[model samples]
Target: MTEKIAVLGAGSWGSMLAAILNENGHEVQLWTRSAAQADELNQKHTNRAYIQNYTFPENLRASTDLETVLTGATEILFIVPAQATRAVATEVDRILAKLGQRPALIHGSKGLETTTHLRVSQILAETISPEHRTSISVISGPSHAEGVVKHDPTLVTVASDDFDAAQRFQHLFMNDYFRVYTNADVIGVEFGGALKNIIALASGALAGLGYGDNARAALMTRGVAEISRLGVSFGANPLTFAGLSGMGDVIVTATSTNSRNYRAGYQLGQGVPLADVVANMGMVIEGIATSQSAYELAQTTGISMPITEAIHAVLEQEETVETAIHHLMTREGQAENG
Candidate 1:
């Protein structure tokens, strides 16, 4: 069942998703605010700005005009930054409102909104009209944009409170290389995906400090515990923390050089300024922004997330990474479960 799909955002992930959907025989329109990016994608069939060295399918189209992309799109995939999600979703509401079109909504972006702490699905639900958003689902896992674009073997879960909707989207992106599974626990999946970035930042800091694998392993294991504790407080199933979005995502993001969060943390550990790290990266580092939100959320919910708190101090409160690590290490010991 080939459908018309509009993929908003022209970054690496959006470009790759457009390529995959195009290959799947869907009429895929990639939307970007950058006219240059749109022209390059439509003319040269390459999004070298983000995903380098990969030629996009010629049939995959990109445009700067929002209405051109959304006029008849049956499904919309949001791959923009989490901070940018609400703005794009609001525009989606305006356009689809006029067209009287109801499209399936799936967000591949992960991160809690800064102050609101709203998940991507929650923002979409609150912004888009009820008539238009009968279903809002999320796709998340260990898959990175660079890897997925290269056809790396990747598996992810699509989640929704509406189980049937989740199953429907499962077939949309599933291929031999990119397999999809259905999950009903949207809260656990979103929290897992969002919170793992903070841990990855800490892991990268360990790597930067020349700490061995032992340090990274300990951080990640304890990171999962912190994640599960908070996720459960938010009504998420604790076992979900053991699944793909949690442990699987945490492993890849924390250990891999491809992760922007890890790279940012690595630079922080090397005494680089936060602004410099972010500017040099030339991409959104979700962890830096997410750390503050995660820390604040933990405070409001009275959840103990020492790792998250430490990283938030480093990223937002001007505490040095080394100092944060020192504090974490010197904290009073407790039972393993505690």
Candidate 2:
């Protein structure tokens, strides 16, 4: 029952999935671009740069060889940062074509490219042919790798336009500690997955300002509204926002102590420079890129997303948190539902 699985990134999230899949009796191969890191994981059984405590599972292997990873991998999980996704996907496609085999693809990263403003699934569709489309799935939600790696109970949604691929992905991920659900709304899933990080940054800003639950609650609720609105504009089902990938993800990211975006924002709110905050966090904060993409998408679609705009402003340091709040609160009045 062991399946050949390849993870394309060896960051924290990638290493976590490699461990989880290995625990599930899968042949897991974790690929990192850094040969030094790969050698360390192969010899030390640990990813010293990311997850420090646990040794990699015995069945899990690490390598810098992309061809070796793709040739034998029947299912490949793409876990690189969102900005790097396209390059990695293109490389993977070329490697797979060279091998004359197409494997199922799963992306665990969240965020759209700021320059292209394309969702991960859309980028994948463009990179791979329709014949390979059925093999793509997106697995995302509130599940943080830090929690999941420790065997905490976490739930996430795996979505594909293709139903059978969703089911197959569900089987690959579901376990006693990890619960997997299936949905066909790939657009909404991807949007919610990316947008929540931006909102979490806003939530952290509010928390750092010593704002009460009222502020956090408002940010979370209205944040979901904006996310859902923008998602529906992209042809995603409006209902997916209420599911695991949307509201569920927002809650976890906005409130959790482990969220990198939230932590970055908290420091920003406490008067730290954005560059310093990111440097101190020592992780890729997807929200920083996602905020620009959301702002651009909102402008293109003529959709109103004040919260995302506020986050964008703060990110650019165009306006302080106080000014951003004042702008939001004193904006022209409209009906609550409008």
Candidate 3:
């Protein structure tokens, strides 16, 4: 069956996913906020600013009209930034209400709401009317827009509290080049996706400071451990941390140059100011905000997340990158399993 899918963001990741879906023979509507971008994609079949060197499928439509994008869509995927999820969901709710239609909701974004510290799915649930929401799922893992655009082998996880919904999402995106797995651990999957960015930033900073593979390896290893600890405290399954959305995500984001968080951290390590790093990146660095939220969540939950604390300190300018590294190294040693 050819499903009509609406993608609610035209950023790199969103546009790339829309292209992939179009390739899979699905009818795709990619919504962008800018009329210029919509016109460009419609006329040129290329989102040059976001996904370079790639032409979108001719059948893939781009629009700035939210109503036109959502009209007759079987599924709606929210690919906007985490901070924008609530606002987008509210708008979606109004549209769904006016249309008297309900569609499966999926989110590709990975981060918590800064003040509420709520997961993306949670925010969606709060804003979208229950009657108008079929199911909520999140797609996250090691997949990057740059690699996915090139059709490189990519694997990701789709998680939902409803197992059937997870399987449905897994089926939707799975293909020869893109593999999807189903997981019922929504909390773990979301946290693993969001928190890994913090570690990526830290790893990038370490590399920028001339640290080698050993330091990066250590940071990644310890980073996943803390992620699992904090996630477990929040009712997430501890074993989920070992799966695609957990260790898998951490490895890719923390080590790959494709990661915005890693890039931001690298610049920070080179003594670039946070404001400058953000201004120059041209994309949202999710870890910068996530670090603060994660640190606050840890404090409230009584979980020990030293790596998150260190990254948060550096991002907040409370400590220099060098000082943060030194403090981490000088911390009292504890059992690896603890």
Candidate 4:
């Protein structure tokens, strides 16, 4: 069955997803905050700033009017930054309230709300009114927008508290080039998606500092261990950390040049200022804020996450990346599982 899908946000990921949905035979309305971006997409069928050298489908329309986009949509995908999810949800809630429409909510953003340490889905539930809050789902994995735009073979997980909703999204997104899996472990899936970014930042920093393959391997392995420990504290299945959103995401984001967090960490490892790295990238480095939230969560839960703590110190405190690495290496030796 064909569906009208409203994709909120016009960043690289959002635009790529909108294009994919259009290719899947869905009517996709991509809503952006910038009228100029909307005009560019409509007029040129391209978003050169975000996804250069690529063109969107002619049927994939772009709009700045929220009400117009939401009016007849059957599903809404929120792909904005984590910090902005609440505000956008609030706006969607208000518009839905007036329009008397309820659409399935899907969020593709990966990060915890720094202030409340809530997952994007949790923030969505809180901001959107109960009546307008339909089934909520998250689509996450090692999939990167750059690769997805190029139609590279990709696998991802769609998790939800609602099983049917997860299946719906899985069916909607799965295709020859993209594979989707459904999992009911929302907590684990979201944690795996958000926490892996922190590890990727560390891995990128190690590479930036001229570390060899062994060091990167150690970081990736121990990084997932700590991530699993912290995730278990939050009632997430430890096995989920071993799956696509977990191990798969960590490997790709940590190693790929397409990851903004990795690039940011690379610059940081090279002794570049954080502000300069962010300004030059012109994209959100989610791991920076996620590291802070994970560090705080670990402290509150009494879980020992030394890697997260080290990354947080390097990012938030004036601690040098070299010193942070030294501190981690000098920590007391323990069992591999301990």
Candidate 5:
């Protein structure tokens, strides 16, 4: 069945999803605040700012008007950065008030709100009332926009507290090239997607510092321990971390150059200033922000997250990468499974 879908945010991920939906023969309206971007997508069938020189499917529509985009839409997908989720969700709530319909909500963004440290799904839950939406779901994994747009074999998980909602999204995005898996562990899936970015930052920094794959392998292994430790503390299923949103995402983000967090960390390792690294990236380096939030969270939870703390120190405390690495190396030894 062809469904009317409203996709918020016109960044790489948003455009990628819209194009896929269009290819799936769904009616998709890709929404952005910039009128210029909307016109470009509608007229040129491209979003050069995010994905350069690549053309989008002609059937995909773009709009600056939230009302027009949300009107009669069955699904509203948010692909905005985590920090921007609340504001965008608030706007969506206002528009939905007029339409008097609660569409199934889905978000593909990964990361936590700065001070609140709330996940993207949490922000949506706070902003959009249960009465104003059918259910909320999060889609996350190792898939990157650049890879998915080219029809590369990609898999991701669709998670929700509601099983039916999860299956609905699973069916929505499933295709030959893109596989969707259903998961009921929303907490595990969301946190896995968010925390792995910090690990990728550390991985990139290690690579930039001329460390070999051995060091990265060690970091990734330890990073999984940290992620699982913190995740289980939050009532997440342990096995969920072994799945796509966890180990699967960490592998790609930490190893691939296409990962913004990895690239940003590499620049940091090369002694590029954090400000310079972000400015050069021309994209939101989510791990930079998530590091701080995760550090704060780990502290409050009284969980051990040395890797997370190392990345946080480098990003926020002006600690040199060398000093952070030294601190991490000198930490008291413990059992690997501890």
Candidate 6:
């Protein structure tokens, strides 16, 4: 059955997901905060702001009006930046409550908001009614919008506390080019999705420093250790760290040139200032906020995440990358055990 889907945000990932849903025969309403962009999509069938090369499907409609997007929206897929999720959720909550029904939600944003230090789903629950919590799902994986727009084969995960919702999203979005898997460990999935961006930045920094495969491999492996240790402290399943949202996402984002975090780190490693790096990237590199939240989360949870700490020092505290590296290298050694 064709479902009415609302994709909020008209950025690369949002446009790509809208295209995917439209191709799947669902009625898709892709919303843009910018009225100009929304008009362009309606007129040109393309999002000039992000996915400039590809055309949106004919079945895909767009609007700048939030209410229009919410009209008959059975499921809301939020593709906004991580920092904007809370504000968007707040807006959605107010409107949805007035409507007297809540749609299932799928957040595609990755990273924890620095101020709140809450994952996307947590932010949703906090902004919306608690009764709506179980209806939230997260779709995550190694998906990069650059590839997904081209109809490239990509694997993603749909995770929720509600197994039925997970399976529903799996069926809703999965396609020959896009494969979706369902995982019931909501916290673990969200944590892995949010935290791995930090690791990607570290790996990008390593690659930016002219480090080879061995260095990136070491960073990726150790990054998982740091993320898993932190997640375990917060009641997440340790094994989830080894799954798609964890190791899988880390590998893809850290190594790929298309990843905003990796690209930002690459420039940073190449001696660009943080501000310059961010300005040049031209998209939201979630790792910036994730790095901040990871540091705060580690300190709050008493988890010793040296890598996350280093990233925090470099990005937030404006510590030199050299200084951060030296600090990491000089850490005291301990036995590797549970």
Clashing pairs for model 4 are: none
**Better structure of 1 and 2 per lDDT:** 1
What are the models' TM-scores? 0.98, 0.96, 0.98, 0.98, 0.98, 0.96
For model 6, the superposed segments whose C-alpha errors exceed 4 Å read 130-134
**How far does residue 238 in candidate 4 sit from its true spot (Å)?**
0.7
| Local lDDT at 201 for model 3 | 95
lDDT string for model 3 (164-219, tens) is 88887777788999999888899999999999999999999998898999999999
- Residue 5, candidate 3: Cα error in Å is 0.6
Q: Could you tell which candidate, 2 or 3, scores higher by lDDT?
A: 3
The lDDT per prediction is 0.90, 0.88, 0.91, 0.91, 0.92, 0.85
Task: Tell me the TM-score of model 3.
Answer: 0.98
Candidate 5, lDDT over the whole model:
0.92
Write model 5 residue lDDT over 1-338, tens digit each, in one string.
Answer: 98999999999988998888888889999889899999999999989888976898887889998889999999999999999999999989988887798899999998989999898888999999887899999999998889986789999999999999999988889899999999999999999999999999999999899999889999998998899999899889999999999999999999999899999999999999998998999989999889889999999999999999989889885689989999989989899897
Model 4 per-residue lDDT tens digits across residues 105-166: 99999999996999999999999977996799999999888998778999999999999999
lDDT of 1 at 39: 93
- Model 5 misplaced stretches (Cα beyond 4 Å): none
| 1 or 5, greater by lDDT | 5
> What is model 3's C-alpha RMSD?
0.9
List of clashing residue pairs for candidate 6 = none
